[model samples]
Target: MTENKDKQPAAEEKAKERNWISASLWADKEDIRKGAERYGEVKWYKSARFWPSMLVLILTWIGAAVTGSYSEAVGVSVILCPLCYLNVKGYRWSLLLFAALYTFDRVSVLYMRAESGQASGSGLWWLLIWWLVIVGATLTAFRIENYRHKHNLAGRGHYVKDTLIALAFPVVLIASFMAYNIFMYKSSLTDEQRKALAFSYGFISRNTDGVINYCLRSGVELQKFPEQFRQTYADEITKVNDWLEKDEIFKSGMEASLQENKEMLYEVFENGRKDLIRLTIAEETGEKPENLVWKTEYDRMISPVEYCKLMDESFEIMNSTGFFDSFVETVKTLQ
Candidate 1:
């Protein structure tokens, strides 16, 4: 009977050891393991709420990554968010900080760039705003759940064991995100697509302004033949320009719009798509892109001054993004 009692304790210890992987996530759980002030502490991980909290944290981590610009606040917020699951108090505090940091990062990016989202015009800020809505919903739901049925877990305390436990969550979150991205890239992207992506990044390096928001590209994805691609871009531009000279559909609209706008319209490229040189004009003039209605194959749209600077040896942007993008799109639509 004594041997059976000894074996029972040994088996229990082994079971705890097995769960230590996930059990390390809890503040009170670790305190109990270390024989600290953790009497009567429940194994909260056994609660179904704990798993749901973990799932939510994982989703938040991904959302932060998707909307993040290359900023320190973004990195910190992404890493720290997952660990918020470590303790309920920590979860609330950490997520609030993340929301603040995300706002800071988004605003800072807009501030740092000469082009404000509203004034200079961008959809990237809208993307950030969308994430805010999602995160806000998540937080609101959390509050409702907490209010209705509190988990009543102890808050985080200053202990090396707990600190280490909290830190591991972020490390895992980051590593998992990276792995997921790599896997997605490898599995989903074709060789041509990846080459196009690389060319897009290369354009960022060459541009004097040096804004290569990875999420947005200048509608160019040329990879097969640069020389031929360039010629195709030129040819398409000629067609568009020629059409502009002759077409009345555009002329009546352009004349009326230009009278008010007074700026040369150019193609503003975005995430694998095109926007407008003047955002309001398209809506203001009641102009919509007709299928095959656009005569221009040209994709790179910049001001005359910016275009001049791009070709200048000093600026070093040689229209690679636009040229390649035009070629690929032309092949898809026309060829």
Candidate 2:
């Protein structure tokens, strides 16, 4: 009985020792083991995780290359490599790394959008998706580590070392590629090109406003003209209407005009004045009749006199031949 009692104490001591691992040290050890396993799996490219991840990476590269977006391909490749490594090894730190990298990548996209003066709505959507994936992967890693701890898995130290090595390699590759791009493919736009682009945007804005105003006034005037006038002017009015529908400049102009007027002219005249003036002058009469002439004489015939004056002012503002020449010169300077 004494011998059995002594043996029981020794067995209890061994059990206590086994359960008494320092939490911090054990966590570090588990991390290292997970990393090493991930590294080995990635390096061999033989794990189940490898095939799908590699397939995605290859497909992304091919798609980006086809679209002539090499930068996108490189970025995707960088992201995919680490993702694959993490999935195979199931490291907690891999999830953290993914989250950090994803955040950094999204910030870069935001910066690019700001530089171009564009909305980042789509970018935000993409970032949200990435965040979800990172979070899901992290939770998966935590579950996996818990399983490993329960199982008392061996060679955790080797696994951790492997994961770190795997992570280091791809990181270096991505950094080198970025450095090369920064050093080699710098784009420096000339002053003239910048000015020309500014002028082009301004010209586009002004013309759009003019087009909208002309369409609205013409539609109103046409509606006021006789039915014969509407038929006679059908083709010309149709051409103008088509231009209003298809021309981006005209559409922009109409939008601008509607905004300026605080009136919904765009909604009213969306279909344009197809039912308006069809007036035709009788060639035999040779009389300077008061029928609504669709010719340049209609400009002189414009009433309220103020509208005519405004039309004239618009024409003068839009008719800067020197400005056009300067715009062309600016484009040349860019080249």
Candidate 3:
């Protein structure tokens, strides 16, 4: 106990003078010259504050990847801490210049998204929002870095010790949080239910069978409609609805994929029926259909790319005319 008490005062005394950068920031040129002679350059990499921010950034990405979600990934702004440290203490304009360049690149992506029906809102509005986020983040980072450097709260240490200590908190927190969630999730299911879910997952993921099943099963089921010559797809409605309502990420993609496949399947059916009539006419009359009838007889022998255009056009027709829901009623009576 006496040894511990003796060490405490000495440790506190060392801590007071440990912030070399802050101590030297206001000292004379001669003091800085002497300190550099002993400690070398005070790089941002030496900042304990910078290391912790980097640790947060790295853990956020790992969380996103493990959860199969993007919210944590979006938290990569935590990295701005160290970058800000680099700029304010080293080259003040570097962050601003990099921001301008990155904004220009992202603008092209945002514009392309707007054109592809993937993004909402006006181009000007989107540009304003992005700039707001970027500018706000840059300024916040600058303030944080300024505070860290000015106080020299970022104490120096061996790189390995600094890195391990910086990473310890986030790693422990995320690991425990994820572990608890996993345990609660598992407890919510019965062993039988879990096995059944595993089986269903395998059935649904007939292609990969790797880890997760990613096929648009609902869309595929919907596409099997009238072509379900063996059995109509009307029966799959419950499964598809359950699948869609169970998850929004799945639900959002469901509509577009279902729309595409629905058009393709429906058009393929119509074209097949029309060609069947022509084939019967040819067989009965012993002659190919004439040019005027040829247009209705053949589907233009389109390539896959051309077929996509036709399907997209067909979706507009089927959707606007209410053919999709009404056609389901017809198939429901297939008994």
Task: Please write out the lDDT profile of model 1 over residues 252-278, one tens digit for every residue.
Answer: 343344323311122222212333333
Model 1, runs deviating above 4 Å: 1-78, 87-91, 112-125, 128-131, 138-162, 170-204, 207-335
TM-score of each candidate structure, all chains considered together: 0.31, 0.34, 0.32
Give each model's clash number.
4, 21, 0
TM-score of 3: 0.32
25, model 3: CA deviation in Å?
Answer: 27
Q: Whose lDDT is greatest here? A: 2
By lDDT, the better pick of 1 and 2 is: 2
Worst 10 residues of 3 by lDDT: 209-218
Tens-digit lDDT string for candidate 3 (211-255): 001112112212321232114333544443343333333333433
Q: Where does the lowest 10-residue lDDT sum fall in candidate 2? A: 271-280
Per-candidate local distance difference test? 0.41, 0.47, 0.43
Measured by TM-score, how close is model 2 to the native structure?
0.34
Please give the ranking of all candidate structures by TM-score, highest first, separated by commas.
Answer: 2, 3, 1
Query: Between candidates 1 and 2, which one is better according to TM-score?
Result: 2
